[model samples]
Target: MPKTTAQLRQLWRAYECNEAEMAAIGFGPDRIRVARPAARAFTALAETMTRYRYFIRPADTDSYNCRTITGGTLKSLHAYGIALDVNWSTNPYVDHPGTRGPRFSPKPTQAERALDVKAGRADTDMTEAMIAEIESLCTATGLQLFKWGGHFGTLKDSMHFELDIGPDDLAGGLASR
Candidate 1:
């Protein structure tokens, strides 16, 4: 069925949409971007988020991991085709020492900030609520939602989500669990 703005807003609220991440790596100047896989998964999880509301955009291919920021870390969910970042104004995955802004702080400059604000409609920061929504969707679909925020403490890549299960069972599980 078609979704109303209210319905999309409601689902977004439940998933904590207000706390969207500022545009950073993978995300171009436009913050309203999402990967094909993430968008498909998101739609499968909750069509309401996509119904009538076209605020999600497509993210870039490179700069998808947190290793750039932490240096020593495990492979990113993007590497396994289960994760994606949103509204990336800068590369949060990169390690920036002595930086004044927060680890995942929203863009500070006017140009960077403007780019992020403009793209926010289509993209989203992987907040706890967002993660919960993805997890819920994965649970309903029988797909495992593996997150970078789950393992790391210092850096929680909010825009990342993927299936932890092996390849042979990636899609089938979506119907089982």
Candidate 2:
């Protein structure tokens, strides 16, 4: 069932967080939005992986929005800033078979993510080892990694990750209509 406005608001206390508070965490120029707890966790993550700071660094990924799942009805965690998308441009969301959903009509590519910009793009060269480290760091930071949409089996969203603190929706983040 869909949560009422009051319930959503109450549940958002520790999650939805104010924009000003989010700015203090040093998420870079994008001023990426993340829950208070999640932001602190990412701070630690960035410190741990100082060498590859650029990779884990938050990009211009979408944050809060309100909407149902792509084809379903439910509240998405993004409504509370619990979920964030990183490197979306380079990491495509693929909807493969076995996930019980149709494939993504137009798959994304690293080349496109590059936007034909200069060299040194994070998505340009990623090795299996790098992915593993990122996954391990994420787990250590109290976050869950959702690769290829995980069990969804429908979308191979390689560039996505969620804190798994609440419901995950695709229609839009908590703020999205």
Best by TM-score: 2
Summed backbone clashes in each candidate are: 28, 13
Query: Residue 59 error for model 2, in Å?
Result: 7.0
| Model 2 TM-score, 2 decimals | 0.53
Q: lDDT of all predictions, in order shown?
A: 0.36, 0.44
Candidate 2: stretches off by over 4 Å = 1-24, 45-50, 53-59, 99-126, 138-152, 165-177
Writing each residue's lDDT as its tens digit, candidate 1 over 78-98 gives: 432334454344323332234
> How far is 127's C-alpha from truth in model 1 (Å)?
5.9
Off by over 4 Å in 1: 1-54, 59-70, 73-76, 90-129, 139-143, 148-151, 171-173
